[model samples]
Target: MFDGVARWWDGFELWLAQQWFPVQFVLVAAVLLPLCVGMAWVIHRGVEAVADRLGRLCRADAAGNGHGVVDEGHGGRPDAVS
Candidate 1:
C-alpha cells in the first residue's frame, strides 16, 4: 500500500513538472505568478497584523487618563503630562 502511494505521488510530481511548451507561459502565469502573489498577500497581511498588535502594545503603556493615548503631536505620541 505504501509503495503504491509512493508511486502515485511520483507520477503526480512528474505530471506537474512536465514542460509542455505550447502553453508554457499560460501555465506559468496561471500556476506560478498567482501563487507568488497569493503568498505575498498573505505575508503582507501577517506583517500588518503584527504591526497593529505592536502598536496596541506600545499604546497600552502610554501615560493618559486611562482611555488609551490620543495622538496630539507630530510623532503620534501621548500628550505630555497627561
Candidate 2:
C-alpha cells in the first residue's frame, strides 16, 4: 500500500512538474489556501480556549480572598497568591 501510494505521488509530482506555471500556481493555491485557513482556525480556537480558562481562573481568584492582593504574612512581608 505504501509503495503504491509513493509511486502514485512520484508520478503525480512528475506530471505537475511538467505542467504550465499557471496550472502549478492554481494547484498550489488550491491546496495551500484551505490548509492555511484550517491551521489558523485551529490556532484561534486553541488561543480562545486558553483565554477562557485564564479568565475563569482570574475570576475565581478575584472571588476568593487574599488573591492578587498583598496581605501581611508570617514575617509582615507581602504574601504570594495561595
Candidate 3:
C-alpha cells in the first residue's frame, strides 16, 4: 500500500512538472491559498486569546494592588516623606 501511494505520488509529481508554468502556478495556488489563510486565521485567534488573557491578568493585578495605581506621577514608587 505504501509503495502504491508513493508510486502514485511520483507519477503525479512528474505530471505536474510537465504542466505549463501557469497551470502549475494555478494548481499550487489552489492548494496553498486556503492553507495559508487557515493557518493565518488560527494564528490570529491564538494571538487574540493571549491578548485577552494578558489584559485580564493586568486588570486583576491593578485591582489587587489597591491604591496608588501606576501612572499617577509618583513614578510608581512610594512618595518620599522624610
Query: Against the hidden reference, what TM-scores do the models get?
Result: 0.54, 0.77, 0.76
Between prediction 1 and prediction 2, the one with superior TM-score is: 2
Candidate 2 global lDDT: 0.78
Tell me the deviation in Å of residue 1 in model 1: 6.4
lDDT pick, better of 2 and 3: 3
lDDT of 1 by residue, 7-32 (tens): 99899778767867666667668988
- Per-residue error for 46 in candidate 3, Å, reads 0.6
Which candidate's lDDT is highest? Answer: 3
Local distance difference test scores for all models: 0.73, 0.78, 0.79
Candidate 3, superposed: residue stretches over 4 Å from native: 67-82
Which window of 10 residues has the lowest lDDT sum in candidate 1? 73-82
Candidate 3 residue-wise lDDT at 56: 59
Per-residue accuracy of model 3 over 1-82 as CA lDDT, tens digit each: 9999999999999999999999999999999999999999999999978876776577568867895254434433333243
Candidates 1 and 3 compared by TM-score, better number: 3
User: Candidate 1: lDDT of 4?
Assistant: 100
- In candidate 3, which residue pairs get closer than 3 Å at backbone N, Cα or C atoms, i.e. clash? none
lDDT of 2 by residue, 1-82 (tens): 9999999999999999999999999999999999999999999999978876776566567658655643345332222354
> What TM-score, to 2 decimals, does candidate 1 have?
0.54
